[model samples]
Target: MEFLNHFRNGLVEGEDRDCFEKFLSPHVSMLYKSAIRMCGNPNDAQDLVQETLFCALKSFHQINDPEKSKYWMFSILRNLFLKDIEKTKKRAEIEFDSVCDKLTDRKHPEGDFLRAEVKSNLQEVLGKLDERLKIALVQFYFEGLSYKEISESLNIPIGTVMSRIARAKVYLKRELLRSESMRLEISKYIGDEE
Candidate 1:
């Protein structure tokens, strides 16, 4: 009967709000510190804490075991933090590509031809990506969003994001290697004069 009451009270809508507030409010400082440690910045840590709490509240009804609530909440936070790390990595890759593109298209044309050749090869590789992988990569790397944010924005799973990125890299590697071979042949034809 006591377990039943606890389970029943866990799902109580208005009642749960007060309980959630009382339970979670006391942990805000700890959550924020954990977030900061995971995220490495105060602003991002705050956002992570808020996002974790919001997710917890939205899914609280599904949590029937009050004794396990802390574990469940921490799970949500850990997942978000890991997703944020992947997002940051993707963003860095995208930014590096963007900078390379800009630099290749602008100055540094007369120094080394191998660098230009590599950049062109990479661009060709990028152009060969399928539409879905292309879009996922763009959203993740170019937009600098977490997996959860990308999932919410694109209405796709976090796993799909991971898979798409993996597939994209495979395709890019194949295309880059092929392009490098082609560049070698083309260079022979064009001659290494000027």
Candidate 2:
């Protein structure tokens, strides 16, 4: 709520604002999580999510199907991330190690350490993935979009979506498994890649 509220410029008509609140609310957290993973830092991730939400709110009237809004919002996020990368001609400069420090100031249980390690492994693996494969994998696994939704969102055939997702899994597994510190089995979290 605060995130959207901060970005609100008071320019949207009352009715449009209400519509946006209901329409875009469900996908905001998901978008933010994806943005953080893509941007590798909370600050840039928040900016990216804000831009995505603002862009979607302005174009909410163009959305036809409510069920499809999830994919549409993701399309906006992916496009913005890719566009930023293209314009800058480089990946973000933020260091992934800083995320761990920002995640918590006080240590807790062993599970927290394990979770952080897993997240670190994932972020590193995802960073190493080819962009074409990374986008599809994030959409399916992170955003929980169906294969068809990803295909439509990326303007690719369903078969291509399946292939890219499969390829991404292989790359992730290989890289993560290669991490000596990443002893935790990824299968439980990775889902059935087959």
Candidate 3:
């Protein structure tokens, strides 16, 4: 508790610290919940919330309306979350590309064939989707982010995220069905030739 107080004191001073504590401290739980939803993991959520509090402390003087402080903190959290998402995405893409390149350079015919088939199928399905739908589906399904989290991250309404996920699923099912049929037809043709 002593350490916490010392840390708090380091964050702000004078009347500003009093005002900041009165307005912002009450909403710590709400911010933690939001951080959890946005981060999708407890450790990351804790880190995010800590960073958000530090930032809020640094800029507490800029908040003019005490009633709007909640919204202001939310906006700050959202920005931090978005920036983290971008950094993660960039790092993942680079790592993914590097792994793909390494895997492609190795010559294992069966493994290569299986990977190619799966990759082609996924690419075909994803390629047919609109960019917005693709991103929405990836964030919700692949990343396991909740609808509210997706809405906050994408800066869209929750209803819009719902509709996009529905539409993307429909498109994926249709494309997969079509691909399956084509593959079956080709298999039959090759069997007949054999």
Candidate 4:
């Protein structure tokens, strides 16, 4: 928190901070309310709000319109919240001993080669996804965001976020199957989503 304040103050300075504050002050309450809803508890919500303010202050220089500041701040807040969740999740998911053992797996050298080939091809296939579907899928799977977070970040309905990710997965499955080598390799590992 101290680091964040120093970093922000070093960048924002005097006049710029004042101008940015004009855009931020009016919506502080609104931002707090939204943060509380998203975080599900008051303590976490307050921390999220503090982080949001620092982030918004850092990037406030780029804003060309005062009117857009509200949404901009909201976006910053949501992104910070999602990032904090992702960090916590990653830390909790890391099992050092098991991970090292898995990384050095000697059971199937050929399996590792095949997995690498499939992963490479998967990237190619992922690139073939429609833009909107691709965005939702990447955020949900890679960034580990909930459907609600994705919806808010993308400014879409939760249902729409789900639909896009579902469609993207279906499209990826069909495309992977279209490749004979990928199908032969991955089919044994992946079950039907339905």
Candidate 5:
């Protein structure tokens, strides 16, 4: 606690980089452990700590309360961890949508074989739809594009995109029931709507 107070005081007094580094080194392991739990990955935890340290150094002058210094660092680490999760989620969604598009457009015999193996487990109703309907479904739900964007990209009216998405859901309901395992997986992905 006395160490923390001195570290806080140094930050408040605009301590030299070397002095700050001495103080920071002692707290590195503690901060890294906290960050690991927050981020759920070792690499991300290390990054979060580095970022938190950078932020703390940059805004050290604003921390007036030495006693609250620990909380301040934790707050910065938490926010960074959450932001990292959000970025990962967005990237995963984009990659999934890209893969879905490629899967839907594949024309090779091996592609068909692979699709047959895995796609059969989906609510087969999706498989039965025309390529256009499949594309519309994947674009709106899988890719999360707005109706306006979908319309412009598909070269169709916005109203058409809306109706197509709605109809796609109905078709999905009918087809997915054919395979219970696929139905459960699909439900996990789609959820109970937005």
Candidate 6:
């Protein structure tokens, strides 16, 4: 039969099928967890996982270390998620620009006030970050690069990348806390006046 001929052709050999199932099946849960975290929605997470699995299947032969398959799968997932994020961001930017153009003709005082407050708070916190820390955070979080990729791109060691990201998180937390405390103090003062 044609099925026998296909099997004889080595397209779906038993060894390849066994290797694929062995390496990929055990990591399905972890992959789904990572996909959910990256996507923030179940449907999108499922799609991401499916896409990652498809790519992994097509290139499973390239995975040299079976022990490191989890990390390899993660790298693939992360890369796909980052590409999706980039495309989404680009679309969002275009839509936001058009919305902003339309909103410019309106006079929404409360909206303006809220936007200014949020912008100022963010700017203050970001401005307090060290230049290197800021760059690392931006590249890792916003640009969606892996620590290894960021290290290569920035010409820094992997250890340095890890440290910078860790330091950036600490600094951001401290700055945010300070900003919140200041805001609360101002709110208290205004309440006392009224």
Best candidate, TM-score? 2
Better of 1 and 3 by TM-score: 3
Pairs of colliding residues, candidate 2: none
Tens digit of lDDT per residue, candidate 4, span 1-194?
A: 35335534655467656855567766677666666545546667678777887777767778777676876777787667668766774211111232223323347677566555565566566545555576576557645668986776678999999899988988878887887766766555564543
Q: TM-score of predicted model 1?
A: 0.38
- Candidate 6 lowest-lDDT run of ten: 90-99
Ranking by lDDT: 2, 4, 3, 6, 1, 5
lDDT of 1 at 133: 75
3 against 5, candidate with superior TM-score: 3
Question: lDDT (CA) for every model shown?
Answer: 0.57, 0.74, 0.62, 0.64, 0.56, 0.60
lDDT of 3 by residue, 56-109 (tens): 877987877777677677667767876886676521110122223333423555
RMSD of 6: 12.1
Give candidate 4 regions above 4 Å deviation.
1-10, 13-106, 192-194
Question: TM-score of every model?
Answer: 0.38, 0.69, 0.45, 0.50, 0.36, 0.51
Top model number, lDDT: 2
Weakest ten-residue segment in model 3 by summed lDDT: 90-99
Model 5 spans > 4 angstroms off: 1-19, 90-194
**Using alpha carbons, what is the TM-score of model 4?**
0.50
Expressed as tens digits, the lDDT of each residue in 12-131 for candidate 1 is 677656767655555555556555544546767677777887787778778767555554665577578657656665221111345344434335454245445655665555645554
Q: What C-alpha lDDT, on a 0 to 100 scale, does residue 126 get in candidate 2? A: 68
